[model samples]
Target: MLKRVLLLLLSLMLITTLLVGCGGGTTEPETPEETPEATQPEAEETAAIKMAMVTDVGGVNDQSFNQSAWEGHQKARNELGVEVNYVESNQDADYLPNLEQLYDAGYDLIWGIGFMMGDVILEAAEQNPDQKYAIIDNAYGDTPSNLVGVLFKAEEASFLVGYIAGKMTETGKVGFVGGMDFPVIHGFHYGFMAGVKHANPDVEVLVQYAGDFNDAAIGKAIAIQMYQSGADIVFHAAGGTGDGVIEAAREQGKYAIGVDRDQNDLAPDNVITSAMKRVDNAIFNIAEELKAGNFPGGGTVVYGLEDGGVGIAPTSDKHVPADILEETRAIEQQIIRGEIFVPDNEADYNANY
Candidate 1:
């Protein structure tokens, strides 16, 4: 009886041990199912570029240099995805402040339009060495390494227009009206006179300066005086003031030549043609270069006939003769090919005269 009892106890202990081992092997706390590490997305990057322009005293919509420069900045904004802005300078004193405001606002490129802003641009560029800048029409001495100076051989186009004036004149007299007394403005006068002489050596040119760019009344009065004095064609380089010259030509039934931009459409019947300086093209090219990371610096860039920087406007379908158009094109080709030289400076003018 004692042996049977011991055997029963041994069997019970073996059964319990087997149960514990099976549970441990099959169902141990599932090593807390390791979860995938959480991931984060990378940030996107954006382009950083800005441009600004300071207009001349005549303002941004002056239908001349200021307007052209503004158009260039607008182009940069549209094509390059850049931020752009502009400030119109009402007086000479406003130039530096306007440029400084743009620079302080973190603009990468700043442009000053017109020769009248030459000194202002120089001063601003010197003070703001970290900023890139550009000036049109004149370079004030040696520009800083961050500044670009743009000038055009406007005399080439003026000479062509003057030739047309000389050929079309019924009277032996022609005239020139300048916006200011600056050497830059005088270049137009000098070239026009030379062209007239080239076409008709006996023709006389009466020259006058309006001293202001926006005074259309003064321009009209001056133009009328010239017309009454037996001048058949009067060429004007007087900015907004030149509008008066066209008006005078229309009133007097005489011919007028426009400048800077094509004014033939202003009075298609009276404006024979315009001496185009390609100011818009210059601004556009400069802005494009800046966008391409090739900003011109520390030097003056002079664009001429070969670069399409200067040319005569298309002959008026309303008034310009086909023969005159053909002859003008022939002369233009000669000038571009170095077969003809148009004078700009006073010394050159005197020598040619």
Candidate 2:
């Protein structure tokens, strides 16, 4: 009887344990497995570097370097995650204030777009020694520690386009309208003249300047006068003012060569080609170099045909003859091979022209 009681008690204990093992007839929701993304840590992102350019009175839309520089800046922003901005100067006095504004805002890089800012850049670069600065078309002989200079071998391109103008002109006449009489402008004048002479030794070339880069009216007036005075083709290095030269060429039924950027679209009929200075490339390259930690600071970067800095635009594809285009390509190769040395200064112009 005691053994039976013991077996019955053990059975009762086993039944209780089985019931508990079955969770006491209760149910619980399922737990999902851990996902890989949920276990991943947050990534650390690098902040973008801020950069900006200050335009001369020509403003950013001048479709020249101001425009080209802005395009390059935009491209850097797109490709390399750079933060870019621009300040447009409406007058001469605005250059200083515009430059200071960007510097004070703590821009990583500030660029001045024209030679007109040479002195002001010098002054600002000196006062703000910690601030980085750069300028196009002008090289400071004694540059500040934080400043970089961007220059071009514009004469080489001018020579190529000048050669085109010499061959294309119907009246044995061509013209040039410049933004200023600065050394840089002289580079264009001398090279264009030299190229024209190379193409046709007796082609009569006319030249003038607007005394300002912003005055399209002055440029147009100068261009109309030249075109009417028997010039069948004109080339202009006058920033926005050159836009007027395009108009004058159209109205006068003449051919024109553009500068800084391609002006062919302004008047396809009138523009034979454009002398390109690749300002966009310069600005983009600067941004790239700065971000790559290789900033070419405290010195000038001179870009030329060999450096892919200067050339004639393809707008002339429709205008340039097959043989002449082939010849120009050969000339470009010669320039690159050091067989053709183009002049860049007044003395050299005198010697070569």
Candidate 3:
């Protein structure tokens, strides 16, 4: 009887050990199930929407509009979880090919950085009707359903800087150096001239066009001539060429108003203000719209002082007088409230003035 009791106890102990081993096997399988949950978010991130841009002739780092636009896409990547990239265009010939490269890569949205690319973007949009595209500084009478056009009230911003130039000039004159003589650039000229007139009609505005946006040497030469001729301040609407304008200001102890981006960093003491276009804001907004399924394709979207799309650099306070900033803000509100119409063209300028 004692032997039978000992054998029964040993059998019971063996059954308990087997049960614990079986439970451990079940938990091991559960770890793999939890692994997929840990990696699921990574999979979603890997499938994120891709966005890209093709730079204009000035390339991506022109320290101008192209750089601003690229910054916009980069901001989208950081805040919106979209992948972004850019391709440099050495000349007009590279526009279509560079765009095609991004397009072929299956980018969900592609951008052409300047008005010079209006035709190229249009061509790409027409060729790939299913693809979506956006262009800065250009608007078309007719465009395909997949394209978006972006325009800024450049004149409004130009007017603000022009007012600053007019008020700050001690030499009784200011200057304007432009990249091209097209209507887009004309907006800058007309509005600036208007603002100078508004502030001091007797203050002369010396105007010149570099005819090329890439040559900093020519821009510097033009600005130097204007300064030598008794102009104390200069404003530039040129692209990379505008860098020369700021350089001349720094070297000549004069002030320069920059364009497209906040160029105060180029020459902190020399660049008093800039006609801020908010291209980065525009591009980021478009990306947000796309992510929200509300993209404004096949149409034009205009940005201006009213919508905070265009304005002067925040750094103006360091170089601009408190009274001038106060007055400029007042004029900004006037434009926003429709009490003032900043002209953007030759006829409108003449009519308004």
Candidate 4:
């Protein structure tokens, strides 16, 4: 009986050992499974950075300043894996609020599209020193260290377009229509007039302002009047209002110069050339710098003919004369070499004229 009891005790001990070994084998697979979940939290932490832009009154699809800037923002988002958004300011009052909304949303970069936003951007930049911002076509007098101002030498390209208009005009009279009376628009006027004078000093250029960037009717009326007054070519620096100028040129069988983009397509037969402003390149460069952790702050960045920021559009299938094209190219080279100074202020325009 004692032998039998000892044997029973040994069998019980063997069963207990087998149970412990099975439990240990099952826990080893669970340990490897938990290791992958530990790595998943790190993957979730790597998210994209956010960038935003606030458009001027003309909105994003103006096919002008707003459109170009938006394209640049998209380029950065795609190439750098950034998240992007844009707010359109239909009224001037929306400028500050739009920028503020973007900042509050934790966007790293907020771009203000035009010079009209200069005052609003200045005030906002001062209030939010921690946020980085960029303003195009204008610079504030007292910009903060976190803000960057992009200014363009638009006159250089306008001058080239003016030369084309001067030589192409069947009538000795030409015209210039501006969106508003800002210095930026004035730069276009001054440069164009200079180019016209350079080509034909005796030619008369009729200048008019639409007084509003968004008013197409005013643009049409001014363009029609210019066309009726024996003007064969009308160069318009107006935004959406410039659309009216293109329409008038097409309807009247007259030539028109488009601004900001390659507007030749707006009226292929009627458009001579557009004074191109590389707003896309400017915004792209700024975004790239911001991504690289190097933001240009507290100073104005001027992009001119030498920097590929401004130039005349390619002559279309309608064809400008070879001699005229040659002359404009020569002037472009001179402008780049600093031999020609296209004025930006009213004083220079008055002095040169």
Candidate 1: C-alpha lDDT: 0.85
Per-residue alpha-carbon lDDT of model 2 for 1-353, expressed as tens digits?
99999999999999999998988966676888867565666787877899998998889999777888888899999998999999989898999999989988989999999888999998988998888899998897788878999999999999999999998888999999999888989989989998999999999999998988888899999999998899989999999889999999999888889998887888998898999999999998999999998888789999999988999987779888988988999999998998887997879978756
Query: Which is the better candidate, 1 or 4, if ranked by lDDT?
Result: 4
Candidate 2 residues lying further than 4 Å off, grouped into runs, are 1-42
Tell me the tens digit of each residue's lDDT in model 3 across 62-92.
Answer: 9999999999999999999999999999989
Please give me the total number of clashing residue pairs in predicted model 4.
Answer: 0
**Ranked candidates (lDDT, high to low):** 3, 2, 4, 1
Candidate 1 residue-wise lDDT, 258-309, digit = tens: 8887788778788988888887778778777877889899999998888899
Deviation in Å, model 3, residue 194 alpha carbon: 0.7
Give residue 326's error in model 4 in angstroms: 2.4
**Any runs in candidate 3 off by more than 4 Å, and if so which?**
1-46
C-alpha RMSD between model 1 and the true structure: 4.0
Instruction: Please give the clash total of every predicted structure, in order.
Output: 0, 0, 0, 0
| TM, every model | 0.86, 0.88, 0.87, 0.86
lDDT (CA) for every model shown? 0.85, 0.90, 0.93, 0.88
User: What is the C-alpha lDDT profile of model 4 across 1-353, one tens digit per residue?
Assistant: 99999999999999989998778445544344444444444445656767789999899998677888888888877887778899999999999999989988999888899999998888888899898888999887776899999999999899889888888887899999999998899999999998888889888999999999988788889999999999999999999899899999999999899999888888899898899998988988888887787899998899988989998887533568888788888988998898877776678877865
Worst-scoring 10-residue span by lDDT in model 1: 312-321
C-alpha RMSD between model 4 and the true structure: 6.6
Candidates 1 and 3 compared: the better one by TM-score is 3
